[model samples]
Target chain A: MSAALFSPAAPGASPSASPGSPELRAQFPILARKVHKQPLIYLDNAATTQKPQCVIDALTHCYTHWNANVHRGVHLLSQEATEHYEGARKVVAQFIGAALPEEIVFVRGATEGINLVAQTLGRTQLSKGDEVLITGLEHHSNIVPWQMLCAERGATLRVCPITDAGELVPGAFDALLASRTKIAAFSWVSNALGTVNPVAAMCRAAKRAGAITLVDACQAVPHFAVNVQELDCDFLVFSGHKLYAPNGSGVLWGRKALLESMPPWQGGGDMIASVTFEGSTWNHVPHKFEAGTPDYPAVAGMATALQWLQAIGLQRVQAHEAALLAEATERISAIKGVRIIGTAAAKASVLSFVIDGVHPHDIGTILDRKGIAIRAGHHCAQPVMDRLGLAATARASFGVSNTSADIDALVEGIVAVQKLFGA
Target chain B: MSDLGDLYHDMILGHAKAPRNFGKLDPCDASALGHNPLCGDRIGVTLLLSQGRVTDVRFDGSGCAICTASASLMTEGVKGRTRAEIDTVFQRVHDLVTGKGDPEDPELGKLAVFGGVSEFPMRVKCATLPWHTLNAAFDNSNAPVSTE
Candidate 1:
């Protein structure tokens, strides 16, 4: 099939079309379920999204049909399995607008993807007195790996600050991109605050300063289209689960030259070209980074997820989520003592807020009683929380399947929490 | 959802709002930090041990009502108790929260507010965090204990 068949939408897709609806909601089996005798309103998409039925079917189909080890096997089942596995890579490449399928490396999710780059590229490229630039709004996954790399290399982690609105401070990236900066790794969207960074601009600044750049797109890919080529970053990463696929699948897309230059992250079977008694020759580019037996079933499911998103058209999905977020921000902000964090002029579908004198855990518990699933805590972005002067906040992130009614339910749940806590 | 009354009883809320022994314990011999990474709930337990007895046991941190209440009640229950006696109370509280001990166990007393924790399995960690910090403080272990 043409890769364009799975592209978001052509020019003719009507802008006024309703992006998400009850019909789209029906495609997800878990949405039909309930918690506490009420229907589940899943507003935790930033953490992980619910898988659609088609994605689940894709996983089942992989095990049912092509249930065999890939790459080296000569049998028909192995060939078919290998075909599906590599085909999934091609789908991911097309999904991200990668230059070649060889640029895509499959791993266990965005965490593993970031770790792979940090261990391999960071180990080789970084040295004493070098610097790795990051933002204050990064998830722990984006921050910790780089911190470890800096510690190992005797380099320092320089953080670009964010405004009180939770957006990256203007000109902070340019100020932090020193000549000794080795690589600048940043999240395309703040997982905690939903503050979308100007990734392309940041990447350009880093590149101009002679530093490599990596974009953590784990939060971005699920909500809208991400063309890696357009962003012009040396690397980009995202997890499959955030994109409505299975949990164990994630994509790490690096420039072909960078992947070839960086040593294989882990020593294993598929990543070796030839093993000598003395030393072994490493495999090429993407395969060099992807070690051990891959999660073939999850990759197959990820392909289906991309196709499903494209069929619905990501533009519409973006519109739908944007609408939900706008409505949520308005309604939640109207509540007394509820302060919305990350009030950037531009944001995605995540709405994080704090109610005066009410702990987020209490809010989460009350929301749970009403069958509303929202995330509470620092959201694995402790630095952001620290910067905001809060221990934690309640977050409601919308996905393509979410609707205005879900936000309404969340507001009602928050009201119930206020009543319970006397906030 | 079990009754919020069961989990967040009036006493639990009262303790959460006005936690007893809630401040720092200066001139303490042993202090340990317990953190629940799942919810970012952190509690610091500081014990001023005099002659092998907890002369002043205080905790300070941010967490849910269950966690704060448990820590507050723990300080109150362990004040002036010997190390051996505190361990016994800790064991009983753990059992009560895990649904393995008597709800009416008089030893728990006000600590019985945690008996409802078994109904919400996830909250057990919140209720038990301060207890773990207390044990860590007793052992003089500086490593921050985690409930994972």
Candidate 2:
């Protein structure tokens, strides 16, 4: 693809003006495709990001060259696979600013990462009358696992409420964090509303309240930088697909001492040090968490994706997406009878809104016909939706590859939807 | 683009905008609730039957345009029809939306406006949730039907 294809600049304008340069966008091959006979305009980045060629090539290379199990066999392929997998762990550790590579455990996604913590650490620490505190803005992935854990352990689940602007109510976390709160978990960036929580403050408060903290950085990691040490959270998790890697690839970064102290959630081949009919000893911290065969290729691809983002620099990606979000919010808000949801003072690139008379599904369908893909639903965060008194909202989430032109197309699509519905 | 127009036909849009019989029926003989968990669309169907015929029917809920319009059209189509007749009509409507039944089938009447829904497979559930709730209501099943 030509550099001009990805350029946000108009004809004869300089391409260097945008953060998502033509060079960056060209690396994503799928961006060249069409949908419904129109150029594909992907605005559903919050769902999953389109992969760059480097990440795709890495996946194919792993399978083609050294398709073998890791940390088991002494053969050449096995050794090579083991090296690649371990090397990817190192890259992930650095990407998220982990103190040690062993702290980075490979999981299917952020959902599994949270479940691992809830089942292992939660099962051990939580007692009857103990509480698990979460925010109203968490996705279902963050909410359901804790609910299951609380049910089994006879623990109470507390929720910190958010405001009409989709931010956590001031002092709500402090109010909810009691001495009996065993764990405090929340998303660094909300998937449904794009609200960026005060993670550092929340973590400190939780620590002072004698609660273990877990940060769901699935949305934050892709848009910006996340350092576990700086945040001082006990555990942090993110999915690779949202970072332009393969699906079923993720990282769970926990404090090394805490991970070592907690028992493994699942047990199988790689997670065991030795097994007898009567008893078994578990492997090290990460391997104990990674049961059976891991998706080594996916891990390798995730590493490549992290490297790709690192090379581009996340600050630039953040700035670019912020611009897109501002543009979308300004344009969409100007339309009569349109209401923007989640009007938080601080947010990421997700722009969710509702029309006065049109349902979100209709807006999604109309946009789909125009080859503009936007998410329209509760975003698996039904509580957030219910808290806001909405069934669903039309969400247009920006990614690195997106441009101002895409936002213009989305605006036009929304206008067409309103006209069709006579709203 | 014209295909989108066909899918959101004037009849469908009209019904979605101002749905007919769009409120709860008090003291109904049989009632059933339908939910599409994927999109959080809910449709509660209430009907009064006499001599195996639907004497009165009303629906109350909020959902996407297709779902709301489907429920509105369904209430109109099922009134005065017996259980067996309603079953046959539902099957025809189902086939019509799923792209199996003939679009020009005279038996379908105004319900044929949904013929375009077949092109969008994901929307088949939206167009059928009301019908499923209607079936459940006829059977007097208290359990809420879900299109997962």
Candidate 3:
């Protein structure tokens, strides 16, 4: 990599647009914490990211100042809460380049967002013998929901395979997009392997084949910019927690026409236009899908998270993570018996690896001793592990706050594991 | 942070590198697979039972050091023991790893190396995978048992 990649801006300095600025790390309070009497080196961004102080403050501000149920009351607290909540929706819509704010539906996380689509859109659009084409590189959330949709609708789920290098097998997706294919859902970035799938191309092909496309952008949204219009996907889902917001916050951005046509998957107080003992009419598009009392503070916090990320600039974050990934890949691969899994040409923040004699769980344990945090398992994408013929791999995924020093710490941790295993 | 010595004692690492009785038995009548869905540590335990005793026991699969070492030590502990004896050993090992069994239980012997497993709560599953699979094998349950 470049020498500039290793150098970070001085700590406690003003924010700079340049990659690996110390100001970026200063914004997150958790990054200052210690683990095991050592400075924490958190590299598990694919699981979730650390929230910046601004996002945390935004959550507290929402609860402290504007705590009220959204969109229902004509009272002042309710109106202020409603404004911020709807404001967050508009911000999310703009972040993803959705056609309208109504196209963005709030869900618990990417898992729930996907399940909403699978139940509402998939249930209505699919028929018996219809195939939902997903890739072999899906997290269980993406896989199981479609499986349930298929099982309930008498449809089938088909997978497009991946190569040994973890890239999608070329032309496999197109080959599987047969006449009966109904929906084609895939990840924009593989959470397990860090492979950045050719989502725009895949979505284009799926659309040409008359299939609705849903891009699981859970991993993608954190590391880089995602413009839904640019990708031209019918539906896209991402978790707010992965984007440096709190848990229980996520977005499912769909085309307005599609959301309009689909019936609400859930029934609750807020989702109804008119409710009787025996009958009910659904509310408007986005509200129709979001039922019950929403987490308004989380919604406000998610908006702040988006704004914080915007201030940092996604391009800078992408470059910063890419540099870290390159440094990690080079350093970790240089170690004997350490094989880096998922060598896709275009990967973002994730670096998955396995030592020849040491199990990933052991690697995780050893790393934890040195105050390093990483995910050690199939990464909820067991299908990817199954495809790679590995039970599990130790994964170190990057975030905006990570630096080359963190990567160095990770390398040292791996060396310690090798020594422990006598590899 | 956990102390590495407590979790991966020398004996555990040694047995992991070269586990004993690690292969499928040809004449095995009872066998069951155990899988740790969390880490994908799979252990296929094969038992050759004669009358009411486990005449021969073997296990084969891929797993972490704790799992492999536990399996290897268990083979030495369970061989030639009656089914009831094996059950007691299993219970003791389970209790020992979970920090609930008597450490001075003389029957534990070499198996006591895993007593440190309780220090790292997450690793208890890794240490106990083979024992659970052994139970399933003895019970003649074909379905894979999962340590979720």
Winning model by lDDT: 2
Q: TM-score of chain B only, all predictions?
A: 0.96, 0.98, 0.95
Please write out the lDDT profile of model 3 over residues A1-423, one tens digit for every residue: 111111122234443445456667777788788987888899898998888777777766766677888888989889877888888898888888887999999999999999999998898889999999999989999999999999999999999999999999999999999889999999999999999999999999999999999999999999888999999999999999999888989999999998999999889988999999999999998899989998878887888778767777899889888989999999999988899999999999999999999999999988987999999998988889988899999999998888889988998899888888898
Off by over 4 Å in 3: A1-19
RMSD of each: 3.2, 4.1, 4.7
Docking class of 3: medium
DockQ of 2: 0.87
After superposition of all CA atoms, the RMSD between model 3 and the true structure is 4.7
DockQ-wise, the better of 1 and 2 is 2
Q: What is the interface RMSD of candidate 3, in Å?
A: 1.7
Model 1: per-residue Cα lDDT over A315-344, one tens digit each: 888888888899899999999999999998
Candidate 1 lDDT, B1-148, residue by residue in tens: 4577788888988898889999888878999999998888999999998899888988998998889989999999998899899889989988988899998999788988888888788789999999999999988999999998
Interface RMSD of each: 1.7, 0.7, 1.7
Worst 10 residues of 3 chain A by lDDT: A1-10
Best by TM-score: 2
Q: Rate the local accuracy (lDDT) of all candidates.
A: 0.88, 0.90, 0.88
